[model samples]
Target: MIKIVVDLLGADKPQTELVLGAIRAISENKDLYVYLMGRKAELEDFLANVTYDESQLEIVDCTQEITNYDDPVDAYHDKTDSSLIKGLKMCRMNEDIGGFVTCGATGVVLISSILILGKLNATRPALSVVLNGRNDKPFCIVDCGANIDCKADRFVDFARLGVAYMKTLGIENPTVATLSNGIEAGKGSDVIKEAHELLEKCGFNFTGNIEGKEVLDGNADVVVCDGFAGNVLLKSIEGTAKVVFDDIRRAAAGASDTQKAQLEAFIGRLEPKFDYNNEGGAILLGVKKPVVKGHGAATDKTVYNTVKIAYGLAKNNLVEKISEEFEKK
Candidate 1:
């Protein structure tokens, strides 16, 4: 059985959506077990309205709540019994528990995971996010928003982690690239220049530096960069998607009925490609166990997908593989 701890008390939406989504997921996968942690009253109240097999769901009472406005570090420290903390603690105690999923503050989740669960080996946990691409394969971006300033060695480790992830997902010999303003080896900053040489020396398939524009073109299987650069790239993609979608919506308004229908269909096809919620958030790679950090404003679907991603990580023994790779370096 795959045990998953879910922090139901987090997120902006009513807790009912999370409960309902969990119910849907559990019903679909009998091998899965969920430990829902949240306020006793709030959780019970929500459960009272839903119909589910009691044997499959376990509720742990957590009176304290972590709000969006609270400082992430302070929230984790002050609210020891917060749903997020409880869920992480449960995962830590139970070896059988595959992973911990939370829509809580990203900072809190990342820090708590590192503090309680610890890192996989010597690697600083990176926020590895899946980037939507034209091909069936999903591109993995490391340090999406985790380590703002990272050393050249860290970037090399990120490359290894990214390759392991892609391999687990069935992509063999994944091409790794560093994000840069130009494709030339000498184009980026001193850090990138050093990272380029180090990655080239590494045994893995390095594709040299990849320009920002070519990222969406599916030029590389794994993209490596410091958190600051990775976060900027991620936000740029999001912002561009939003702008294009808004323009499409406005254009649809002026089209004929048939034309509008076609436009909507096209938008529908493109929407999922850029929807971060659909892909869940990013994985905190290099941890001893799989830890997924969902968006603070994550919905039921996003939470569900996060659970699935965790399950995949555990089943594939991703952490173990990463450990072996790190040991060799």
Candidate 2:
């Protein structure tokens, strides 16, 4: 069975929907088990009336909650009983537990995971997200937020992790492209220039430099950059998606019922491409185990999909395979 740890404190209310989603996940996946990490009393009271197999859903009480205000370092040492820390510790110590799902503070989780579980095939763990490409295929971006001030060599490590990550999803020979101001090999800053040389000559299937506009054109499966740039790119893409989608909703508001129906159908097709809920969340690639960073404002649907992602990752044994692949080298 592929075991997953799902943090229950991300939701705003009494966690009714979150608990329901957890129950649904286990009920659907026969061999799946979820470790719901939260307060001892909270979960007890929460799950008391809920209909679910107690055996299938285990609770690990972690009362202290980590907030964005909490310093990563302080929270790491002080908030040992916090759900974020406890969950990471669980994934680190238990081999049966293959993945962790959390919508907690990104800084705290990333720092704690690296300190507790250590790195797999990377210098420091990176935030990796699979974005839907224009051609309907998904591409990955390593170092989306973790490790902001990365070195040229760190970008190389990101490339390696990105390649193995895509391969795990059954994509062989995934293309690698360095994001630059221009498509020319000599385009970007000194760091990009140096990294470009290393990627081209360092046994990677490098497709040369790619401009910003070409990123969504599906020219590459992995667009590598420093965390600063990568994170900016990610937020921009997210904002654009929200604007575009929200605009569609506004346009449909005053339309006729027929037009609204047509728009809804079209939106249903477009949601899988732009919805964070459908995509689950970003993965902390290069960690010792599977760790997913869920959106803070996630709904029950989003929570279910994120946990499903963890289950899928564990079932596929991707983290173990990546660790073995790095060890062989």
Best candidate (score: lDDT): 1
Indicate the residue-level lDDT of 19 in model 2: 64
> Residue 215, candidate 1: how far off, in angstroms?
1.3
The true-versus-predicted C-alpha distance at residue 100 of model 1, in Å, is: 0.7
Worst 10 residues of 2 by lDDT: 10-19
TM-score of each: 0.95, 0.92
List the lowest-lDDT window of 10 residues for candidate 1: 13-22
- The candidate that achieves the highest TM-score relative to the unseen native structure: 1
The CA lDDT at 88 in model 2 is 84
What is the per-residue lDDT of model 1 for residues 36-116, given as tens digits with 9 covering 90 to 100? 877667778878888787888888888777877778778767888898887888888889888888888778888888887
User: By TM-score, how accurate is candidate 1?
Assistant: 0.95
Residue lDDT tens for model 2, 205-320: 78988876777777989899988888787777777878988888897899999998888887768765665545678888888788887777776776787888778777877677
